[model samples]
Target: MGPTRVRDLSVAAVAVAALGYAVVTLMYRHFPPITALSGMSLAVVALAEAGWGFYVRAQIKDGHIGIGGGRLHPLVVARSVVVAKASAWVGAGVLGWWVGVLIYLLPRRSTLRVAAEDTPGAVVAACCALALVVAALWLQHCCKSPEEPPDDAEPAAE
Candidate 1:
């Protein structure tokens, strides 16, 4: 399969943002208060993915096809790619959701006590989601094999 497209992610984010905004607008009063740390889980995942990406890149660069002296299965890389793609999409959607909520909340922060209190959490969440997207993309890139020169290319003179 081809790499994940930014345009597709963008569309998904926009759609989800609209939906999230509508839901929040209609049911915000019934929802519990957002805590400042509510979105930190995503950040943790992002850090893990980034670390994995570095490890994968190192293993591949060293021409070692294994984990800790064992052969690295092709499926592992494929699975990593899938996970990265999925995480990127999820992150985009979440980022969009937070942005939408911020759009609604920021203007009312001055007039609404709840909105004021929730703004910091939303901002934090949005940043974490963005980090996830970046880390996932990095992981996906690290999983790619190096490119080979084309057969028709001329050899350089010694």
Candidate 2:
């Protein structure tokens, strides 16, 4: 067996759960059709978004963080990061009934583009990606990084 990615596993689980919910909802459309379908749609949306989110993260991996040379170009990497962040939002919006508005509020065009490496396209891309991640995690209830460690904490007493 090989190591499995947590992000991939989570996305798959959400999708499977959504599929189950859909089957059950479909079985009872006559009893509560509209409400059930609406809920079902939310599940599906979340599954799709999470799947893509995991994919984006998988594509970037650890080595390309600063956007140096790699199989995925700097431009593509930037787009992937944006899409990942969007995926996170999509999941939240689906669960919370506000995905449509949130999608509308996002910037749909490239923040910047340059063929020549004269400018740090990759750098800008990385910054945008990091910002998006922070926003997404915040919206999803993840605690932000601690501001400062206890000054007197003695290196874990090791």
Best by TM-score: 1
The regions of model 1 sitting more than 4 angstroms off are 66-68, 150-158
Candidate 1 colliding pairs:
65-72, 66-72
Indicate the residue-level lDDT of 40 in model 2.
41
Give stretches of model 2 more than 4 Å off: 1-33, 62-70, 84-158
Each model's TM-score, in the order given? 0.90, 0.28
Over 69-94, each residue of candidate 1 has an lDDT whose tens digit, in order, gives 66567788889999999999999999
Candidate 2: tens digits of C-alpha lDDT, residues 3-91: 22337534643564465445533542233312223334434444554455454455444334345554445565445445545555444
Query: What lDDT score belongs to each candidate, Candidate 1 first?
Result: 0.89, 0.38
Candidate 1 TM-score, true structure as reference:
0.90
* Candidate 2 minimal-lDDT segment of 10 residues: 96-105
